[model samples]
Target: MAALTASQAPGVGLGGHDGKGADAAGDASPGDGSYDMELPPLESPNPPGGSAPGGVGDKSGIPKSVLAAYKKAAKSLATSTPGCGLRWELLAGIGKVESGHARGGAVDKEGTTLRPILGPVLNGAGFANIKDTDGGRWDGDTTYDRAVGPMQFIPSTWARWGADGNGDGRKDPNNVHDAALAAGKYLCADGRDLSAKADLDRAILSYNNSSEYLRTVLAWFEFYRKGTHAVPDSDIPPVSVPGLGEPGGGPVKGTPERGGKDGGKDDSATKPGKGSGGSRGNGDKEDGKDGGKGGGHDKPSPEPTAPHALERATDQNITAVAGETFAARPGVRAETAKGKSVKGVKVRFEIRGSTQATFEGGAKEATVTTGADGVATAPALAAGAKTGTFTIRATAVGKNLGTVDFKATVTAPQADKVTRTETTALVADKNGTFADIAVKATRKGKPLAGTTLTATLADTAKGPFFSVDQQGKQVRTPVTVETGPDGVARLSGLRADDKPGTYTLTLTAEGGAKVEVQLTIKG
Candidate 1:
């Protein structure tokens, strides 16, 4: 049965009925018996605008397809089985309490829940264990069948009460319309009048035996009936359904296991399980087994064991250049308290320091499972653009195990080596004015474009050198020039002062590399 709670929504109770003395009719039955109740005319809570009371629309977070199916099923039940007081809100309430309208999964326009929903295996730990009934055809567990569909019906129960709400001829539990109609029919069976508080409680309890389940369904029912907004209150603890609570709360191992492809028989529907009020066992009473007295003996449920153990992530230190990719060393491991390796444990990797340093080959917040060796390996880690240290954290699912942090250091890029060459030496003409001297810069024999070259005379103010303007007048001795694409820089119009002699010309590149050339001038 679905373990929904409405503590989040204030004002609990269904239309003022508090469920006290509501079970006077009898303990709720798992939806399996055939009802002889008269079918009432079908009606819809939603008006022409497809909005229910309290102005709740799709914004209520209830899917439109699911809401429409509820209305359709309610109308179908009322038309086919009159005088049952089957309201669309009541059907919707059941859907919400059972599976969150298929846990925000896919529901098509034809009122079909395209995604298959399965509950956990009833393995006697926080649940009743029933052997497989359908050869793993329905719940996928040949050993034990689970409840299936948005309404959370066990396969055996579905076989007994399944109906084709969409007129599809096939009665599929995964179809919302079919499941909704089947639920409505189950609620109105035995000619139970739902207009009365006692009858309503009896009908809901019949679906699931928990008093808290009744309150939750009714709370959602009232929420829909009044047309209030559908914000679920966080304060209210969610009820545990097969595969919908803590690991072992449901058939699967995870929190709020919405739905999966597994199939199984529902123990609550077949046997007198947790919420069945200890009444009928395995649908035998109606079949004339023990004459209405539950004759099947139930074994005591097993106690919950401690959670699986997880060790801190190993190889937490990594170093790399900015924007470089490297393996995330120190893989994480999952193990038992005895220090033995445990495989298939889910480990979540989270980025803590910089968004730039990401888990390469996967999502930033990716979850990877441990391999056979109990070690979970992370994809390559790419450092961010800037140089700094960041942290990546690997934590076990549910944190029941533990977590480890990996630190990464990124450094700046290194500079390249360069050399300077003078393609042409400096020489003075008869007037003692020198021609342009061409110099080239290269890094490892390849032209190093964009290098800056500066020329300085051995003596700035003395006889050897001087610079000239466009008009041929002496200017200065030191000059700065930038190299072009071919790595060539030109120093033009160097003039020797009237005193001619051999002079030293120093050419310096940006990185402190210098070349000295002898210049000869004629007076």
Candidate 2:
């Protein structure tokens, strides 16, 4: 179930530098950390892509499974708490600084880390003293509790914020999906919107409560938001990261200068992967070009990113019934100018117009990153009680490519009961017609307008007949009339065959609704 083979994957452990890192601020337990965990090392070379979750901004970064977990967590919150506005990039930033994405995506296909990521023991020794809460269940320590899992949730904190993200019926901090969700819920608690700068900072600080940690995570977060591409979750390669000078005092492996837009990411203030997180490769050059392993080890330069265009992958026009799921989900593809699939483009699927329809988790808008296939499909959409036409627009972020719009139509619901507006009596007119009476169709008190109702006289031989037309020339025992905006269908033009007697008129509408109105005639 692992994204990469086990033999090739190394055991980097969780982010921690021998569990000796300390929180300089000396504040309360941030969230799930006793001591700062060492960042995972970035070692993936320019390898071929895989089918599982994969993508980085123009490079092979973040294991496919690990990336998927972050996105899934954010998507889950979008529905459970739309006000949170949790973005996958935010979670990714933290993950980058936490365990270097499970030591650079050394995770199984199900987003479970191959190893149990544990931090230093929290015995009040240069770290928060959090005693064992899980009885050594998570951290394998009975005396003290150390941060565990890819997101580094302490046992006590995990107990409260733990979530079943993968639907595996288990809440495991070692699983990236579970940890990402637990982390996301914690960040979104108290109705805080991460989109706001203040709230965003607060949430990050609550996780580690360190200004340096916050800055490191924010750097990664901002970089991810810019864009990413799917890289193979293979063994990490030997490359130099900016600020973490070469071990042999050799020139930095990265060909590009630091603090630039391309590879030398602008996360310059705090050196990443110091204690708990490890540094990813920082360079614009592809694979190996700085002559690392041996001479002639240089490879060709990376291809220039071509312009991309958005194409509709799913039905252009979709439909649904009120209070039902949409038949088909809207999907889009990002293709290069030469029609080749492009990876790492951010595609935003938005629900707009006059409808209360929401994607899974009650979210109207969701952003999905393009996977290896350059495809992004939105979450399942559900039409709420309100019915009308709406639009699902898919647009590629940072791309000049135009958007694709999916026209969604939600039809009216069936009526449950048909009742008479005036239950008193229907008086027959001497002028070959009956006084106008109305029957309404409703579903749980909500008016169901535009419903068709048929009126039929019980005894057609002697009772009044209905005028099917305005001229009264076309008459019949049963006539059909559609309800108006008030959900009431007007019944009129009841003519008798020169006979006077009390009769019953049966009105039937949608949803097996049948009502009887008494009609009295005197001759």
Candidate 3:
């Protein structure tokens, strides 16, 4: 793996540039001094799928075309470097920070940003003074140059890392897909393993020698990884500080504010200073320009440690008849070693067994984010078409958190039958009471007591069944009754209006059988 070259040209500004301070020296050597440190690694890989687990559609607020480009580049890199685990979220983070995922211009079907994105001119006033290296070929400036594209690559840097992400013949910085892939390649250089936090940080720093820049990028990265849309702040050019103002408070003669003046030079440098405040700089310089105050390359804060290992708890194992829904009580809880709750952790639920189970709520897979109570509930589990036992497993995001498994049993009833009682024809009278109807449930030729039975009338308008309880209140359709000691459930007080019609009643016994009967009511 090639280490990022230190002799590279001056960086395109990484943040807002106020042009108030003297220009940082150009050609300060990439990855020099404070920007020269190696990064540590995080524990897990943030994979590059469109949505978070169990989430669907585009939720990152990024344009579908741009997001697709990042995903493609990530997949290509990951496929090529088996263990690299490069993910699209990281690329998205960089894109968001660099250029709002190419929000500065119109992106066409070819994933090209119709408008060229350029940063401030690296004149001594506030940014590094880069004597134009592209010879007015890409940026059109024979003097100083600017950054370009969605990822904001200076011509020199893009030259070393430009890639063809869209399968097109040429590498174009204006094309988002190509720019994103090039950015990924640049980050993954030096054989840096992103799975570790240190390496990820180092890679991001190399992109733009700024600690704040790294933080902003990582924050967006986390949001993207969670399948949440995170809109980058507006790209208003930083206001020049009052006393530190430039000659005209505008860009120099050759360098343009928004894009390259001519196509001769590549305007791929980053924004000059930090946003709004215009406090930070990109930190590199060239020739004799005053070295701008680069954003400090400081190590990020340490990762938070849980006091205790994560654990899974369930109220009870699930038991249901085949084809019925069994609500799983699985709940994930994280704690410190001292038994304190660890909130905000993500827990994922997976089903495993000979029989398949569908997660309730139409989720392809169930995942929940832990709340303040440190618990996430799995959706209801529906048994497979055939009866059998299955296992539900709950796992935390990181390996440090433990895992738990729960078993569920689904059984098919044997010898269950529902029989309807023979009854005379019912009449629709002014008073509305009809003839009595009854049904019996049995399992293995024996009465099935304590079974709940439900009855529904096919046509509710013509003959509405109303049952009066001890309170004499009328209960409408879907009348429910429980089987007695003899396994008999009876229905009475069925009413029909003066308009006579035929009606069908459906009877269903819990865990038993279903039967429907036809009845005629005459006016």
On TM-score, who's better, 1 or 3? 1
* Per-model C-alpha RMSD: 20.7, 18.9, 22.1
lDDT of 2: 0.63
Cα displacement (angstroms), candidate 3, residue 196, comes to 0.5
Per-residue lDDT of 1-523 in model 2, one digit per residue for the tens? Answer: 1110010012221222222222232222323332223222244334335534233323336667788899999999999999999999898888766665665565556666544455555665445555656545455555666666678777777767789899864576777898999889888876678899978877777676556666667766776666665545533322222111122111222323322243332211121122111111122232444434431211212332443357777779998778878879999887642245678888899998989899989998999988888889999999998978989999876554557899999977778898877767776644467778788898778888888888787885665776545764546557788988888888765666566778788888865688888887767
The backbone clash count of each candidate, in order, is 35, 29, 53
Arranged by TM-score with the best first, the candidates are 2, 1, 3
Best by TM-score: 2
User: Residue 138 in model 1: shift from native, Å?
Assistant: 1.6
The lDDT values for all models are 0.57, 0.63, 0.57
The 10-residue segment with the lowest total lDDT in model 3: 240-249
Which of 2 and 3 is ahead in TM-score?
A: 2
Q: List model 1 lDDT by residue over 64-173, tens digit each.
A: 66777788888887888888889988887777656666544345445544333555455444444556555444454556556666786766666677788887445667
Q: Is candidate 1 or 2 superior in lDDT?
A: 2
**Model 3: per-residue lDDT, tens digit, 35-109?**
111111233233336453212332256666777888999999988765666789999877755655665223666
